[model samples]
Target: MSVITQPTDLLRQQDPQMADVLAGERQRQGSTLQLIAAENFTSGAVLAALGSALANKYAEGYPGARHHGGCEYADLAERMAVERATALFGAEHANVQPHSGSSAVLAAYAALLRPGDTVLAMGLPFGGHLTHGSPANFSGRWFDFVGYGVDAATGLIDYRQVQELAHAHRPKAIVCGSISYPRHPEYSAFREIADEVGAYLIADAAHPIGLVAGGAAPSPVPYADIVCATTHKVLRGPRGGMILCGSEFAERVDRAVFPFTQGGAQMHTIAAKAVAFGEAATPAFATYAHRVVANARTLAEALEERGFAITTGGTDTHLITADPAPLGLDGPTARGMLAAAGIVLDTCALPYGDGRGIRLGTAAVTTQGMGEAQMAEIAGLFAGALRGDAAKTRTDVAELTREFPPYGA
Candidate 1:
């Protein structure tokens, strides 16, 4: 099949203005390699579904239960999505309604926790998301969130410390998962701690859902009372979120999402999510997930070879954190220089203080079809750019990205 298929052709002929938008996007992707740890490119099929005719309709409730009429087709689509998601994650019920990962977290919290209840969560600066317990977020406003952090010296979560916090706080829920940590959390350990303290275990697997689904990483479905995740990250889906839980909590979860938060669901995005779920169920997604981890490790090794200090000594998943101090750069500077060179990535603080580190991942590059060999090339560009060779880095990134355009375009 040709790379420029019917969609590209139809847009070029019927809608030149919209065609220009896509062309510009294609040009950008062809000239830059993205390394942002939380970002990934969805398939063209997913995009097609997102922009499909389903967007024209309004569906106010779940299948066989709606506040409005003319929803038979919408009901079918929603049911397919719900069933596929539950099967994929091995959960008893799934809600594909939350707008984003954070929204899903809010729904779970609202369902399982009451305001002013004490909660235990990982510290935000230590790999936890803002929704977990950040003061400015609703999670913090509604609950007293006591946090645990990674050991300062080891850069890893201290399980004993978490257990101690749970015992001390007597939390209503113990949130487990991270946006930046490398090593896997002991979910069963967390469950044990939660049980001992009479707290519910909520696993925020937004970063590792794809890995878990592929069996390359462990699943928390069996132990966690509720699981929340973004469908876009490693799942390679449209930008949406999901809430998965066992039958025991299904009613409360649904009620929280419908009556407590949000109005009509975005049926178009749901359709796109359904397509993404189908794509993720394939054996190819397993291969893709495994390669993402492999690529991260390779990139980490390459950076360490050049004297950068990797967080936790290495990565066991799709992301890696490296101190830019050795390269004469800080997180902000490294991010700016890399973006100018068309290599997009984020600058993040380490588990402790304002530790200088640039967080990188393999999903975007792997989506662009670059394996370990190309990762080595991109890492070299980063090393050069950070070490006072910006000109060479820009030139090299443009060349390498042009050769391996994302989506295989």
Candidate 2:
């Protein structure tokens, strides 16, 4: 990469107005109600680490060794992150290099399976993510993938079907976990199916890592051969990803992340990861995790009581997925309406529902110090907006947002 010796001069000369835009964005983050399931508010300390001096370094290898020079500080920062991550998740090995959850999954696939190998994953409309073998992504194009789905009656995974598919296809890996599925995944069932078929088990705990770490949710580390996650979501860290695996695949996973997928680890991101890991070790993080779940359940229940159909009946994690078709709303329309009303949710398709549902979470609001009371009010705003009186809903949300001011920078 070419060096920019006068980045400050360039910014000051060419994009002074852009600087003002950034400040306005910060003001929005502070003033708005953020219900996006995949987003969270990181600590000021974590943000500082992400913008620290460590970003200037170019360390091409793991701690203690590098392909480039000047890794003394990088070694310390990376080692801290590695150690904390292992302790937090009880994993045998951890790779903090992948830039996002998608990259982490790619690295795991690279380490465990060959291109064109058969893989079994959850279907997208049924609460699965695109990276989990959607046709538009590389995972689908390069691999022969068979999918399993939730039971139409129960809205939960049907393990018998998964078993039958595994026996028929003989996949090399079985991927569990999801982006919008509300109920907890039956990891043990997935493990049994993988074992029956002699396949590796990979758990994409991108949305539930914080719950697992906080002991509020089940740990996939004990059952999964590899666990991939994003630092951003429920982890409430900077926007990055990680891959943790059994000791046997340590070298292979590292090689896949470094030589195969990514060039060099972003030292600044690793530093931020260390900060997040440290934060996760604290009691406050555990409380935050518990509150996130509590708020989600409360919101889901309130929405259901208001006549909206909640997917999977309710939520056991940070997100709530509900179909808005009964109210003449599609996913995109529901999302736009909520954003306009300042309630801020994303649109997603339910596993078996006929229409799109909005996916909302309590992480950001919880970070802003809103409790269950605030969650109830937010749920009211959602109901009002869905009922087509978004003006009043927007005013209500703005008021609630004012009460729970943003975590000051």
Candidate 3:
């Protein structure tokens, strides 16, 4: 085996400019509160695996069945990822390839739906992802996509509307899950709707797979015909996607991922994913998952106390989407203001209209060992930033971040 050098050393030797960029990013992450719902600080062990020599290989097929030579180690890594994922999600089969969350969704679509097939999914502006049939994405261009939105008054998923749309569209597939939804998706209800319309249910658990595996949220594996997720997010894994399904659809999903979506899998990333899966299966991860939800609730309450309107009232998961209009700030302005204070988050459009909203998550902060008290402090800093005390809030944020260093220092 070839020896692997530290990223800083190797990059410094090859390109000093790129090395500076990496160092700057590392410092930024180490000093900031990462509240982005889709982001996390992967472990150092995962980073090592990601930067390993396994990246040099080109593994084109599943374990024990590869098209290329010299895949012994690659096969081991991929098999470990597949097994751990299957075990983690309690699925009959798991495909550990597919380069991204988008790729995974594409593969799932290809495996189940034909061209021009109708798919009923949540509207993009209503918290659904682009791959969930946004008009600009391939999912929308290739297939007929009907969208459902939240109830206008409550800002919650209108299941009655979903069923009505399902019955009207008679879609071939019903996609569930969202990028910004604060409450747990009614997966069983979606399954029922899909059954009523003779449609396959695709659960895009990309944002909450860790919560599912940690038992903080309900698992969709038992209800949906196919489930897709990105290994990052709350899972705290490398950036990659996975597909989980029953035995009947295993082969179809795998083929769609391989010949249909991508070529050789990234062995290094797969190896890192296996590491993350192992970490997630531990008992400690369960506590972390629950704490993430707890912290989110605390933060939402804090924000609400300061006069911010949390969409859906509050959060049952790691994410919270707050209407920042009451704060006299638009989504972009709120994001910029908070970012300047070293509090990182994203801006999203509200479920209805063109108004902007602020989306916050507790996964990364909880991972950094922050608890409810810290969440309250963070929420205070958020209010301070919006209330024109950004400098003081920045200092407070720095102090808090110092107490809970990213990557555990």
Candidate 4:
């Protein structure tokens, strides 16, 4: 775990002020909880790769070809990242150079659609990412977007309604993924709908790509024409994005990610992604992935017992979304209370109402070696944080986190 401290140690000599900030962040992570659905701790090996020599490179193209000289090491890193990603996800090709998940989605759009081409995606109110056509992003400005949503009663995708919309609008592409849905997407159903309407199926598997790599979740590679994901989240790599597809769209995808959308590759993050893909292929990561789901399910049930309305009844993935209104609190008020009590998480749009709900995940806690029992403990903490004295709840959270340090015990 020297990987966690060595950089800070060196920075403390030349730049004590910035060193103090890093130290504060480290202490905050160690002393509090991380329930955010889109966050996780990267392994030390991955961190080392991120800080390696490749960070200085400026490679601007795919392997065996570049727009800059002295890209020998940079090309090597990208090739390894591409190969490992293709193997890990069972795709024919991978572009690991997009700076973030949103960028990957942009490249996917660039590869397949023209300006004004209609696109169908989950509505932002029901857990969709902003790239799915938020008015604030490029996708909304350039393309005509139609939104689909979950059933208000069941809190799940309404496939029949999606089919009706797809046929009516005949969009050029359909996107399947969400930021806080808490369940596995039916990729086969999406593929069927897309095929019936002559639309390309795009799977934004950012949140579940790690589970897919570990064999804990179904693969979207076999079903979607294009798959977009992040190298972080449950994948536990440095923050970056990648695109996967069959060879048929491989060239178009690569070109879109390079000159059309992004600049030089982030060689360091790509190297770190290679390390994570290697780790995820191991037996240990598979166990960890399944345990993430187990902890999420247990936490969801426990929260329901304590007066939160669990979305979709429970979770089949690491994510869980719940309403705190049953406890006489709204999402923002509940979040402020939890933050005061040192339990970190995010607020999400609810399926049934105009109000927001709390969203959480078990990846970080599972990485800290917690299990189902600890998940129940966390739910108890949530209740106390929302309904009891803030100082007492904060103390209990600190005590619990001390028992399981993120880097080590």
Candidate number achieving the greatest TM-score relative to the actual structure: 4
Query: What are the models' TM-scores?
Result: 0.95, 0.95, 0.97, 0.98
lDDT of 3 by residue, 1-409 (tens): 1122334677799999988887788778878889999998788888889989998999998888998999999998998998999998899999989788999999999999999999999998898899978779998899998999999988999999999999998999999989999999989899889989899999999998989988899999999999999999889999999999999999999999988889999999999999999999989899889999999999999999988889999999999999888878788898998988888999887987578898989998888889999988887898888887878888888888888887554
Candidate-wise lDDT, in order: 0.86, 0.86, 0.90, 0.91
Model 1 — TM-score against the truth? 0.95
Clashing pairs in 3: none
Clashing pairs in 2: 126-351
Ranking by lDDT: 4, 3, 2, 1
Q: For residues 1-409, what per-residue lDDT tens digits would candidate 2 score against the true structure?
A: 0111222556657798885676567667766788899999888788789879999999998887699998999999999999999999999899998999999999999999999999999988787888888889999999998888989987888889999999999999999988988778889999999999999999999999888877778999999999999999778889999999989999999999998999988999999999999999889899989999999999888888877788879889998988877777788888887887777778887776666778888888888888888777877887788777978887787677777766542
Error of 2 at 191 (Å): 1.0
Candidate 3 regions off by >4 Å?
Answer: 1-7
Name the top lDDT candidate: 4
Which candidate do you rate higher for TM-score, 3 or 4?
A: 4
Tens digits of per-residue lDDT for model 4, 7-29 = 45678999998888888888998
Q: Give the true-structure RMSD of model 3.
A: 2.4
